[model samples]
Target: MASAAATSVMGSVIGKLAAMLTEKYKLAKDVERGIRFLQEELRSMDAVLQMLAEKDDDQIDPRAKDWRSKDGGIAEEIRELKNLVSEQSERGKRYYDINQCLTASAQPVLLDPRAPALFQEASDLVGIDAPREEIIRLLKCEEKQHKVVSIYGIGGQGKTTLAMEVYHKITEAFDCRAFVSVSQTPDMKRLLRDILSQISKSDFDQSQMLETVEQLIRTVKECLKDKRIITTTRKKAVANKCCTGIAAQMYEAKPLSDEDSQRLFFTRLFFSGDDCHPDLRKVSDDILKKCCGLPLAIISIAGLLANRSKTVEVWSNVLTSISAAVEKDSPIDKMKRILLLSYFDLPHHLKSCLLYLSVFPEDYSIDCRQLILLWVAEGLIPGQDRESMEQLGRSYLNELINRSLVQPTKVGADGTTVKQCRVHDVILEFIVSKAVEDKLCYHMEW
Candidate 1:
């Protein structure tokens, strides 16, 4: 009987202790005593149950069973403890508004999808408004020319995004417009039919789709007399085909400046350029620096850091992970896709040349002549004696530049020859990753 009473008391004490632990409730000396008592009583009751379980069935009959192990009891101690616990729970429930508790307790807030994002703030953060406006202005010009403009940049540098912005801004002025991806190895008939149908707002049947390439080209020429269409591609070779009459004017999408890079790093993370947490400032800055102002890199890394606690130790580990990723070819998933597309598009010879160049440290400018000599020495330059090895190497460099994979650092006065070139840091990381994946090279840490 005494032991059963103790179990009831312990149950009540545990309930009260749980209430006290809630921040909204007060913890008094009596509450502490109740918790301690509850723990001790639980230990004793556990031993009792264990003993009962082990004892012979004859020794542990219904009469020997206590109230805890029995069906029911209304003894004063049991009844009183139950009442106390019920009353305490009712009081706690009155004070605990779930919504209020959640709002007050959460740290490092999350975005609510119900609210619309500030897109102008984004355009401002990434500093794309000027270029976007310029593209729009050029597209809307009243010149008699075809006015086809091709926007170019390394992968993940927001070429498509900037072009989309311009496309939207000026599409209404054209007779009809459609934006479509002309992926590598597009079927010319289908490709031209899609462009013609979209620009003229006509849907072609299967029979119409069988029209000759010359007929499709004529349709494009006729529709584009005053109307305009925009297409994006990874290579200038592809862009030239999109233009039927004159070559398209090329607008290069430059990487963000340092100031814009910082703003973009913070904007995507916190949705505001301001409001960086104090503890995260240094680590956030470090992460942004590694991004090399590439939109995809900055945005992907920011998404990762935002979910994590803003502690130096945690962020430092992420920094180390990014460094290891560069060595192991395991960059963030978004960056991997962008870079892999560019790397795969290269010809076999260019692929070897690009991967070999990855051996240079990030951001090191390669003199065209010297890089050509190195390629020639390694027998990487492709030829059947059609051109000298050095000339072939420079031709490879020029081709890569036109494809926007290799950025020319120093151009001759005529802008025809690239004297020096350098890979963007993001591309360098990707090339290193490819090299590691293919077992072509492995990085060593000092």
Candidate 2:
């Protein structure tokens, strides 16, 4: 148990160091190499800890102090690493990748290529037809204007699915059309080439493609003249840049109505509620309320419950577990699987920044300014050159917003700046679970 605890702590420190290495990035190559070596060693330590963990709990000797080093070199080594990191911070280096890293990197490995809910049959895609049709109408109505209409909203709101439905419905109206995914890290040159080829119905050669935003715009205009192009991305910022010279409109995906939410969840769980016991229906409704009209959450939970036997006791126990888990509970495989993609895509600095949000309760409204101040107090947002930690913190928040991990709930009157934000309950659950796993922080609920 002692060895396991030590390994866990070391692992957390190593993770923070890696995050610093990526975002802070001030140390010399040798220091950077040292951190990597330590990271590998810590991973090995975790393995040893796991072996120790596998021993019978009853057989474990709490009095055994062999886990501590006799030579005392381990403590000294840790102190040295800590001092190196501290020295780097004391030198006053600041974040420099705001302009560069904010955009998608050239090559990004999407953690999971297949999102199950996104691929569900159209008939099974409850509550999507209305918004999907309206978006298509807005796009088709302005056909002469060559407009770019985007469906934007928080993650798990079915933006991609809605956009795809619209894309398929409207494809026949245009001579050429392409549907592509813009990930957290998007290679503009490569993505554009792929889009251009898909729309042009040819094996487009890219041996000498220029790599500039201006060139990308030129290529699209020249090749896809008067032809509709559609893309599904997480943020309005990316949508605006997708076709800068063209008319771009953002259509926010509406939350599923109460009726729709329950209907979809119930249908997925059972063919009809008529066959269910009266008590089961009540518990099902409670579970659906927790889903909060987010299709991903509802579908995920329904998928989780599908294999289980339907009984009042079973449903009630499931409800109690989900309510307690506060996003981490219930078909955890569903919640964890979907949310991990977004989590893994973030830079190391942002990892802690995003997870710190779990300290707030699920569905709690966070004032943007106050959140920034708290981050400053916690020293999570470091100062950048000529930029206050406040400014850097705000940028970090916006970056999270852009990445679709943190959803902005209310905007300022100008409708441009985010005044308030909230993490999706399902995502908040993910943050809590992860923070616990990383030993970053803990939450206590009565």
> Under the 3 Å rule for N, CA and C atoms, how many clashes does model 2 have?
0
lDDT of 1: 0.63
Candidate 2 per-residue C-alpha lDDT over 1-446 given as tens digits, one digit per residue, 9 for 90 to 100: 45544554565566666776774565556877887887788677656566666676556565423554221455445556666766655453443444345433433222111122223367666787788778877667544556667665666777766877887777667766676655344566777777777766443554145668677768776776655555655567776677577676667667789888877766655545565667677788888877767776776566446536778777777677666656554433434553564466578988989989978864567999999888877879754442466767877776676555666666656544677887766577788889999998976643
**Backbone clashes under 3 angstroms, per model:** 1, 0
**Candidate 1: deviation at residue 416, Å?**
52
lDDT of 1 by residue, 1-446 (tens): 44445554555655565665665643445776775676567556645744555566568767656533552343354556657767876776666566357535634222221111213233453678898887776666565556677776666677766877777777666656776654334567877777756655563443285558887777666666755546565566766666646645667777777888877677656666567778878877776666666776765465455555767898888777665545444334446653554456567988888888877865567898888888877778743342455676776766565444566666666546667877756677788888898887888753
Off by over 4 Å in 2: 1-120, 201-203, 206-214, 231-246, 325-446
lDDT of each: 0.63, 0.65
